[model samples]
Target: MAEELLFTVDGPKAVPARRISLAEAGLLERQHLQQWVIDHPELIGNGVKIVTFEFDRWVSGAGSAAADRLDVLGIDRTGRLVVVELKRDRAPDTVTMQAINYAAMVRRFSLDTLADVHAAYLGGSTTADEALARLMEWAEGVSDETLSPPRIVLMASDFGPTVTNTALFLYEAGIDIRLLRYQLYETAAGEKMLSVAQLLPVPDAEEFMVRPRSSSATQAASRKSGERRAAAAQRLIAHELIPDGTSLTVTMPNLVGQDRDAIRAWLDAEPDRARVRWYNDLTAPVEWEHDGQRYRLIGLIRTIIESATGKPPQAQIWPTAWYCIDDGRTLNQIADPLP
Candidate 1:
């Protein structure tokens, strides 16, 4: 079974909002953006620090600068000079020719020309000498023979057929031209989000890279080899003993003698951790008279640890093992346990 309640209501239809014009929109002027860059002007890329943003007249040997509100000129930290032309809505009629003229102007800029531009742009804050020096430094790896070309950057919301065709043609003709598409997004809270929606140099998109595993592996191996070599050196020094009364002399067989001399000389220079022991392999019984007790090096190590720490070690502590002296055959055979 189904039951229903009825209600009647009348409402007026609402009209859709009209699209905003470019002027009505809160789009920032290209000059305003340039000023923003000049103020902060610290563009970073690939962990590199860039410190300058500048503009110059587009066509070389033809003008001082593009007429005001006509075109903008600039250089990035990479020492790459850029010419920017902005269209209010669709592509402007003269933008292609304008950008071409600007590129030509950039070609004429030499060290002196760049210095003049910097001084004009930065005002009394910079001297021509300092600006020229910086330009030379930036030009270190750049070839002096060829006329350094400039990159062309076009900013617009939409491109007309002629502008699009021109840009495409110039790009294929080996001109470094890029189109940046700017878009506006509005939030429900009446907030606007202006963003760079697309860029023409598609392959040069931002990316993140991590260190390769092989590099870490190589570093780890190097560290291990260093530790092993250090351990071997320390063990060689440990096998040597200083001679009695003779501060510069040591008692060691001339066979393993170099380390012994080194230790003896070091001790004479500085008596640190000083001790003396006869050279006897652990396999061969060593008899040492300590407090009328015949203690082997192994027995001495055990007794020292037991008395110092007041704890019984699990294994019978012994001196480090080496081959037997008698036959140099059976290695590290413990003689008889303490009877």
Candidate 2:
């Protein structure tokens, strides 16, 4: 045979293309995608368990052959079932409706529906059915009043508007919905990588879930109101403006061990400030008044410490009395010796 050469009139020869596998094309690694739920089961909403299961793979008694073979099912701690529908390429409009059908089947039939199928298809004994029985037990544990609605976890690399809009609408109506977006990137070495990210509810949901007014903010405002209280207590200790022998209550922030020692030394050096009768850690009414002026020393200390570090330090409360006396001086007059 004569030597022959193949020729093309193209401007440049086409380079050989690398073949991408189904897992690689979808950016799914065998390990990460297969056991994804087991690794982070908490992400399956708050109360759901990622169940290892296989449904009938065919719908019967429904009188319809259009039902899809469910890929996975997750039952929550509350015994409500969550149907998970996965799409490697594109999840179209019908997927949600399809998943809902599966959910309906589970709800209508319960795990008892799987008994015959488990023996024939799964080839597992009744012992293997414990996982399914556990689901029933969990459901029975809940009282009828507190049962939550069934949920759906729609997972895919690319999701269309059909599924997205439906999921959002159902979520607003109190139905639990979780969306998992998977991304695949190909490295220069031809290895595929998969990354999973969750889409959580909107910020407004927090408002409905929480009290309209923030407790923390209310607490902060109270602290601000108490500054004058602390200052008033300081004046009561000095006996500057109060009538003699008048008893008054005062609030003082619990001093730390180190500060306590320093103040004790200062008290020994200069006995100004009224003599503290008995310091009570529990302050009844938690408010103090002296000479028609009120002092919330506990709140003031919190403000000071918080301002210093942008966070309030843990504090203890002390309720003590200040009496007008001749040689009683305030905290300013006493200073602990430098350690």
- Off by more than 4 A, model 1: 1-22, 26-70, 76-78, 134-147, 199-339
- Stretches > 4 Å off in candidate 2: 1-47, 52-54, 57-67, 114-129, 136-149, 186-192, 204-339
lDDT of each: 0.43, 0.44
Give per-residue CA lDDT, model 1, range 287-316, as digits (tens): 332333433333443443344345333221
lDDT for each residue of candidate 2 in 100-207, tens digit (9 for 90 to 100): 777666555445443333334334453424333333333322222222235678776665666766655555544556677655555445655445565535444333
TM-score of each: 0.44, 0.42
Query: For candidate 1, what is the total of clashing residue pairs?
Result: 9
On TM-score, the leading prediction is: 1
